[model samples]
Target chain A: MAKKKKAFDKLQWIAAYKSFVLEKGELPATVRELAEMAGQTFPDFKKQFTDLRQLETAVIALYFKEANDLLMADEKFEEYSNKEKQLAFLYVMIEKAGADEVFLQEFQRLKKTDRGFAVRLMRFLNRQELSWAELSWGASTAERVGVNPKQAALIQHALSTLMFFLKDYSEEKQDTDAYIEKTTDVLYRLTDTSTVRSMVDLGKFLFSRRKTTFSWE
Target chain B: MGQDKIAVSKYQRAGKLVNTGAKVGANYMKHYAKKLTGSKATKQDLEEENAKDDYSAFSELKGGPLKVAQMLSMGDQVLPKAYVDQFALAQNQVTPLSLPLVRKTFRKYFEKDPLQLFDEFSTEAVNAASIGQVHKGRKGKQEFAIKIQYPGVADSLQSDLRLIAPIATRFLGLKKKEVAPYFEEVERKLMEETDYRKELQNANEIISGCGNLEGIHFPEFDPQLSTDRIITMTWLKGLSLNDWLATDPSQEDRNRIGQLLWDFYQHQFHLLRVIHADPHPGNFIITPENELGVIDFGCIKHIPSDFYASYEKLMRSGQEQDSPELIDALFALELLHDGDSEKDQATIMGVFGSMFQLVGQPFYSETFDFSNDSFFEKIYSTGMALSKDSSYRNLSARGSRHFIYFNRTYFGLYQLLHQLKANIHTGQWTFIAA
Candidate 1:
């Protein structure tokens, strides 16, 4: 009974995290405030995390975890190729984010203002990259591909690029669908031809360095 | 196909129409001016000049204007032989959307370059039509034919029809109100044709309806690759009727292929009351094995139950030698209206009723030989004489609106089988209502 209560409590805070972002147009000003808004105390909020910054990181982490859970629950996931799995991941993430235009815009604005916010984005990218690598290479093939920083960076760049489009995608999302299909195709091609020569060329001058110039794909 | 981009903008399209109208007006003024000056410009000279301008305008502006031109060109009762022959070429001469425009169209609906969707996608269109163009594509081991519609065709068809109404009225010698029904019918079908999603639905319905049948094939449509303006389907393998004819197939081959077409139409019209409306030679492919391959479900006509029953009544009246009954059927079908005097009604019935007799002749016979040269000669000459007749011209310039596609399909079939020089079992529809 106590374990079930704890799980339910965690869910309440997650739901509160989403509603707070949606209603207040931002995360709580502080953990105590979040606790107060969620109808909990600071001690209770601290049980889940050490600080407000960790809670913010958890909010981003929750999105990926939910998407990954969906991927696992899907019966057809095993039938898809590694590239297809990555594409499926994108669709799942977009669906779960449920973050509408205002949420996306506010997050984007926050991105521009907060330098520390870059660390949260990097964490998100790293998690996505690891998920992609694990699905794409599996345990046996992953060692053959090696732990090349360039390969990791290329995926990071690709995910970061995809997020930018997903953030600004209109309600119809016809443009976003095209962007996902096209960018993933380019990523698949780059990964398939990942060799010493390709990796060297990629790493030498920001290989997979999507022009730092930001634009919707 | 011309290298120039298709005119999609309403203003640019209107500009083309205005230019055509200006030329026609200028030609008329020149004819009068020549007469006033006592120049030696014959009526034939003036006609040829106007025909040139009309063809250039309709054929050059290749969307709804060109489609209207093709319809008018096929109207034996409307255009002069010279104009008909000239405008018929408009069906062949079309301006394709450029590569950049095709890509842009794909992006608008699909949000991806077509190249990214398929392993191989042709840059140039293989077949370009008034509403869309088709490209060859391949994904993995599968081949596909992807159709990309010109942007804004759905929005522009209405305005285009409005602009062409007056011009079609003058050439066809009809009042504006009389011409409105024909253009409205054409517009309704054109709007449906421009919608690829609807075409996809039609394709599925047709495939299901015809699945168990032999000697006919409908391409498999991929919903994943299809949108409102774009459709990707499994590529059909066969030769177009003209290309197949060029290969000099045997008489047996011709007869076999012709029979497939005949039976297909009979089944659709009599049982289903639905027929493929656009039946030009391009929409049919005569396989090397003498089977028929039907493509382009873009335009389909569903004959209402009452209309079909009344049409059958007209045929039955013709069969029973009941002139009064035949006249009543015509009126019921809206072929002949209420206002005509008895004498005018008789003359109108005599003219159109004879045309119906010729159309019904095949069904009356056990097997009909389309290779009868004199029979075809009579069809053409009689059509020209009836169209050229002054008495018929005085009648209203409309018939049953369904007659537009009803006549198109039968006439197109007659012309096609005649070209094939085949003998067919036209007796299939005799027991249809049974």
Candidate 2:
């Protein structure tokens, strides 16, 4: 999320994009096509934008906007700690805004000969996801989980794998039942603490809903 | 002994053995590689290399250790169908060891005859292992498994490593300074493998260190019968996870076994502070109840306290885009080096970095599912790529480090579990990490 002028006329650009799309409503476009739509010369367009996804990324700011508004509108997400509340806020925002679908369609359009939005989409999800879920397991989580740092990292690594698997899975909604089921299965066996209830449980619920998956064999 | 045998002098015999063994090795891998990748390759090409290697080793493969080395290394990656078809037909493939050689191994390592100790010694080998053959016998009421070293195996190792060095380097692209760490690590492990006494010590340490771990089994040692060349452990029986998984076990079965395997490794990597570094399938047995039986402590890989700690940091740093600092730390830890040229270093880094990302992915997971073929493929393909780099022209003498055996062992074991589709959360990693 970069700062834009408070009174900048972004709507005007959107209107222009719509007009362009009216005649050029293809699934996605290459850098050449995007340059043509924007009424800019190819060389200048390439200079202005390193990739076509830069344009799509500019538009993706809208989803983040929707997410932010949803977060501001909801108060229950505020009841948790800084980390949990942040995750809860993002979870609710994405769910309410159909964030996954919007981003998927946007990404499909932006993925061309070279410009890939998958990493950008990942960067966005990662930016907003607001959980250490994707990061390597470190001392803090290891202590909380009662495993050595390496083993903790390994477990966390497994969770991250399921996250990647979810990205490639073709399904409706998200599921964390199995993730929770699987997580708690290992969690309970290792430690007797109930402290991971909210954090681990929430991760399970959201991630498992999308389809808890990945083949190890 | 026959006096009519060619009277090649000691140097001549050594030269012949070394050359023959080297050619045999070179030919086997080339032939095995062709057979495994048989798209454009023909039976003639396959047999041609096999013959070349066999012809080279013809003078030395006479009941020596090279035969077993061939078998184990062949099992490494997927062997081509043609090679399997060709080799499978040669049923009694390995050189048959003479009774005198077995007696001599006992006499040299332990001042006794093997048959003098065991209640009944089978003159015939029951099954062939990577570097040895198994003989069945009974001591009191217990059935036993005896792993007998091939005669002159000790003599074969240096030559094998020499022949293996150049190709292995090309396979992995290891450089000079890099060679010392890798081979130092490998030699240390290899030494334990050669010295059955050290392996016996390893077996005792691990069994006692892992005392009464539920679902874990260790064979009782008999010092009266053990020796430097032969290790006699109680013969245990069960289905390998490979065989078990092939039957398409339920997720419950997979998870149970996966968890056990994970827990066992965690214990070794952490508390015992020593690892049973061998990844050979024969080292493990998975039972009907999902119990894991680990044997063969001969291939033990050791980690200094500081090295393990540094390695833990390295594993953690690898999770993010932290290569610069990671490289620095790795250099500090001697895991990576500027040993080769700058370009070569960068190329090796790029190759290994990608693999680190893949292998390290499970570090972020709740638990890695060993059965995932895609995950396995990612790591395996990356490894194959890493091995094929020209920058590692001298890997054998350079890259064969002790620290690397852990990674190699795990890679091999994980491939087996990957096929089984086991979903082990490895709960005990948490306990060990604690």
DockQ of each: 0.02, 0.00
TM-score of each: 0.62, 0.52
What tens digits encode model 2's per-residue C-alpha lDDT throughout A95-117? 43343453344434434444445
Candidate 1 chain A minimal-lDDT segment of 10 residues: A1-10
lDDT of 1 by residue, B181-249 (tens): 877888899889888999998888666777667899878999988988899898888898878999998
State the DockQ, from 0 to 1, for candidate 1: 0.02
Best by TM-score: 1
Ten-residue region with minimum lDDT total, candidate 2 chain A:
A172-181
Model 2 alpha-carbon drift over 4 Å, by segment: A1-217, B1-93, B100-116, B166-178, B240-251, B323-328, B335-353, B384-400, B427-434
For candidate 2, the per-residue lDDT at A42 reads 55
- Cα error of candidate 2 at position B10, Å: 8.6
lDDT of each: 0.71, 0.53
lDDT of 2: 0.53
